[model samples]
Target: MKRLAAYILPVVLLACACAQQPQVSEQTTTDTSTTTPATASAAPSAYDANLAFGPDKVVELKQPESNKVIIKLMFKNGSMSDPKGKEGLTYTTAQMITESGTKDMTVSQIKDKIFPWAAGYGANVDKEVTTFTFAVHQDFLNDFYPIVRGLMLNPAFAEEDFKRVKSNQQNFVDEVIRASSDEEYSKKALEDLLFRGTNYQHMVEGKTTSVQNITLEDVKNHWRNMFTRNNLMIGIAGNYSADFLNKLKADMVQLSDAKPNIPMAGQPNKPNGVQVEIIQKDNALGSAIFTGAPMPVTRSADEFAALMVANSYLGEHRKSYGKLYDKIRTTRSMNYGDYSYIEWYDQGGSFQLPNPGVPRTANYFALWIRPVQIGEGLKQQYAELKDINVGHAHFALRLAMREVDNLIQNGMTQQDFELTRKFLRSYIKLYIQTQEKQLGFLMDSRFYGRQNYIEELDKLLANLTVQDVNNAVKKYWQTENMYITIVTDDSEAEPLKQALLNNTPSPMSYSNLVKEGLPKEVLAEDDQIANYKLNVKDVKIVDSKNTFK
Candidate 1:
């Protein structure tokens, strides 16, 4: 009941806020002495225009919308198209196009043109696709559209601009990501561990060494080959006229129809047991832990529906009522939060909903444990515990594993299943709240070859039961064979590695003597969790500076 209330209370408030005015059945007459009554309004505009110019370009135009306009250009080729040594080439090229000068305008001149219209253009390069998004108000569409068109049609890859973008890319890998951040480091490390030998091994940003190797020739060559006419899909949603849509389509069709023969991602070999990669950093505050196994399921599969329900019960992205949240954060107060995912969920630690345009051909089930502060608080108790990340990391790992083991072993109850499904059905309504968001999701659905995911999920949840969810869990979810990546201090690597290999217990110990209101069963459960068996196949610590090199 407590868990259910945690989820339901907020939903009730949202429902009240969304209450609509009473509906009228027919037109009613009003007296002419005072005022005339207003006539009925027209039906809402169709959400999907579903117009296609050719085999290459498909457009989804939504109506009954606001003054804002969002245009997304999705190229079928992404980082996977990068040549052997040039990992970050695609992302660098995208940055150069968006941030660099155009053929007619300088970089600063391009910014000056768009800034007056309160519009901006950006690009995101994922594993399988590179999406270029253009956002502007309807009033400023004329000014913004031409600038973006210039970027797409005739980009001036100036040598000066390429040098600057490449330098920034290198700094991001060196200063911001690999050097300063544990959470960010763990994220990339997880991917590298999962797809070590494959093309999907590196982040879209590429590695530090790869960024250094990328040249002006590489960027220009990649852009010409990958960003061709046949590899594009345009998504526009706003208050645009039919004439405007036609013009945009015609302008987009001028490029040559050439598609790159990119290789699809093959399935990574399953982990033998719990493999661990400990990145040793001296100045780290807490351990950033991430673990997962590759999943064959996607939205197109029937198993995906059941997996959604089971994953929500285990850990729904930002929700507080997930089973992992209840077990780790609520019960023992281990970390800031604990969450699980059934797909390649980026920004799972902070964001409420999934971001669009990151549709993946290959997906994985992952768990993120935010930095733990155990060593900082318990240093005086244990002299060897110099790094707080190490201690908190050990406990957080055990707690996370215990919750997953229980869920996979015991499955979910009818009450648990019903509450999650009910919550999920209503929560999904919040996904496509705006015209731009709707357009983004629509493009993603088209990419996955699905018909309106939001509507389909509603129907699936309405009919799904506990048995259905558990059966999916048994088929897809697992604990024994998985990949683990943790970023922590060099001093604590051997201790942490030894702890995992030895199957040591990480029991929860209170600082104070008082044990007044705590439940004994919960405490006993933590004991078993501390000793939970992990078949750790390999464990090694590498220097932080050396990683992503």
Candidate 2:
């Protein structure tokens, strides 16, 4: 009840204040002595567009609404079915089959076949699923699929090609990580801490550790495990042949077999004890402190909403959580702009970015403070942030989600909506509608090894309530086990470090340390977090309302 009251009180007062305000522009009444009655006004616009996601697999595909077609090809290949230790084997093989040369073709031969149509094409990897795609004229649909199939099914991972591509990816990783700026380093650091580790984490060119070890045999084995008919999901949306569909189906259905394991549902819970690790660079501008806890791998609708409410208090909402910026940075101003967020991840978390100079990491969830503050009042700064009124934070959550639902639904162009539906089609069918398979570990650990979570999530989202939001806060947010992380300049950070070490701490002096530690480069940049200061808004004073925990 108290949780509900905290959020409700501010709104009630705001409602009353609005009632007293002038609504003259929205109304027109003339001269003295004559009374005019007011007519009804239109209701405010509040739409939840996802309410249209619907329950069909074909996706209520809205036609070209225009003539040009959007081509989607499942472009399957023969990879991932073989062995484990040899990872890069199939990737290397693709260079020969699709990059240029195939059965009746040279590099030039492949392009010559399609050049007359002035079409477009591309390719990508998914561990178990890789694809080559093209967008060409509708008239050439029959001609295009045949060429794509020859390229996809016959990929040649030649030795010379493997050496060159592997070298390029390694160089890309080296350059990005080694050259990251101070900000970039901090960003990556956040990612590292967020996910706890990078095992289930996605990596573009793997890590420095894995990249160095990859062999051509690895690519081939990786391809062997993935390339097979049993694992294919093909979607082609354009003007094409119905009779050809049966023929196309016949050509690809012959091959099916077992494959190497794609890592399954394994999500790491928050680390039990509070600990901190620092990444050091000789001249780093400053450090970032990351505060976080494990969040559910997938949240209920209420918890998802409360993620907004919790985040508002933890980091981003300047108007509500702005006090965090003020108490930690502004009172003295060390934060160029520190951000707190429950970073998104459908399964575990992703890898740190390729930038070396910024803070990037994969910690599951975190509130990140950049640079360090050299201060004595460390305890007070931490305590005040917790002293916040979470009810006020709930207001910010409502506003953010209200806008997200509105934007996705009403603001989407028909073309984008169709594409979104298509992108989500497989996901919805496999995870929501059909429910036998879920993405990897999400099924095993979370669903009791059964498919219960599919219905659980649906029912939870369907009957989602405000009370659920309140309960999540009572269970997660208000818990005494909350952890803290603060990143700041190490040398200048000594004061806060000492203060944390010493019980006696000064408030004003500590605030100034947060300011002095910032790099001159960051100070020069007029960033929002850097200059943030707090002056609480003046709302009408109401009778005291106590919210006991």
Candidate 3:
């Protein structure tokens, strides 16, 4: 059983990296009530949970062996919130919090104290949440908590510090925005276009308007809003216990419980369409084309497990569609590079997942490619996808990663092992559902939503027939299964656009359709250059074949 394997995994170690302990084998789990630490040692251990962490004051003890601890706090420092399209406000505020003067320490002194802890701590700021994370060795847990609390709770919001961080962020925006041709920017933009009209559309960098309007006070305010006792979750997994819990409580006494001031969850609207936003320039050595749209993963026939397996095949590349580009473009001389990605963000007002801001009603997949051989290159990719057949090999990763994840994350420190065990339970539930589905289908032909994702995924992989995956390909993961594309500076870009427009089997109107290679004009168009907008309608959801002459 899934639980049986997980329970026994601590009996062995997988492999070790330099300066780090061997990775514990694991499978991902759902949230669960915690169990006490095992009274005896099974085998060699990573870190003794008994020695590393203390019990949480806020949450009840459930799983004590969890490696990662999630701690939430109730603190409100609503210095500033960003205005639409006025990016970079939340970050501008965070800078004021940490780098600026604080009540207990000057900005310089604060950074110096926290330096040993945070190599790269903070990210993903928006109107809703601003985070400051500083990670240290489990041994340094008690030692570092106070320093973080001081920076977070008692900030000076100094004027001079405000001026400096804002200037630095502004410079970064100017430089990064200007370098639109870089591979990363092209990929990032492609994602933004797909998930447009949501707060997720903006990255950690808030908008320019938001940044400009942000005052020192506004920055402080956003920080203030993030900390509520109920809204916060704190998990410290290592060798720790009751004494450590008391010490943490004493240290964090300043953080009193506020009302349930958790930030509102990200609502999932039934948003559809793939919008396009392109940046054009001359002499861009290569083009970047991102194709994507919102997908229904959480509420669909394919569950997270199924989707994970399906998406893994679409990308023989690394994170965010880079692999496909290289194999097709760099390897075959198609273009510069290619990439792909599928992810779900958790938001509220829809299906609920454990992690907030995790996927609820939605999942998004992105593909990036620079075409050196446009016609053939695009054709090659779809052809490969068309023939993609999932088998034990394809889904083997689910087994491996799940186990690895379970082993690594399984423990008492994390009171919630329900998620992990739930997934495992579903593994058993897989075969049972298959049998039930057959009976229901024969009885009425009206059986629907009968496929439980986790159970079905295991059965599907364990007994995957070629026809099974091919059928899914025909039904769901086809080339015509809705997508988007953006191409940066290239002489080949326009010709490729022309080719897509004049598809022999399915011709389309290109006059106002595929945006031509051109620059963006905010106020008015310069007469000589073509001004293009990758409008929402331009989001190509590759669906049924259109009428062909």
lDDT of each: 0.72, 0.36, 0.37
Model 1 / residue 80 / CA error / Å: 1.2
Per-residue lDDT over 76-127 for candidate 2, one digit per residue giving the tens place of the 0 to 100 score: 3322221233233344444434554445555456577667765545444432
Of the candidates shown, which would achieve the greatest lDDT relative to the real structure?
1
Residue lDDT tens for model 3, 1-549:
000100111111111112232112111222223433223223212222322222222322222442322232212222122445544555565555556655877856655654564322332233344334333444456665665566555767778767877766665454544353344555545445544566555544544445556667666554554443323333322234556644544444333234334333333333333233344444545445555544544433544443443343444233323224323433334344444445432221121221221112335554545433223233344543222221111111112222222322332122122232333344333222221112211111111232223335455455543344334433333222233444444443444343333321211111122224322431122221111111233323211111000
Model 2 shows how many backbone clashes?
A: 75
lDDT of 1 by residue, 104-222 (tens): 98778877666656666677788888888777777888877888778887788999988888877888777677765577679889888898888888878888888889999888888
Number of the candidate with higher TM-score, 2 or 3: 3
Of candidates 3 and 2, the better by lDDT: 3
**TM agreement with the true structure for every prediction:** 0.87, 0.50, 0.54
Off by over 4 Å in 2: 1-62, 66-143, 181-198, 201-204, 236-256, 288-292, 299-363, 368-465, 476-549
Flag clash pairs in model 1.
375-388
Candidate 1's clash total is: 1
Best-to-worst order by lDDT is 1, 3, 2
Model 1, global lDDT: 0.72
Evaluate residue 484 in candidate 2 and report its C-alpha lDDT on the 0 to 100 scale.
Answer: 38
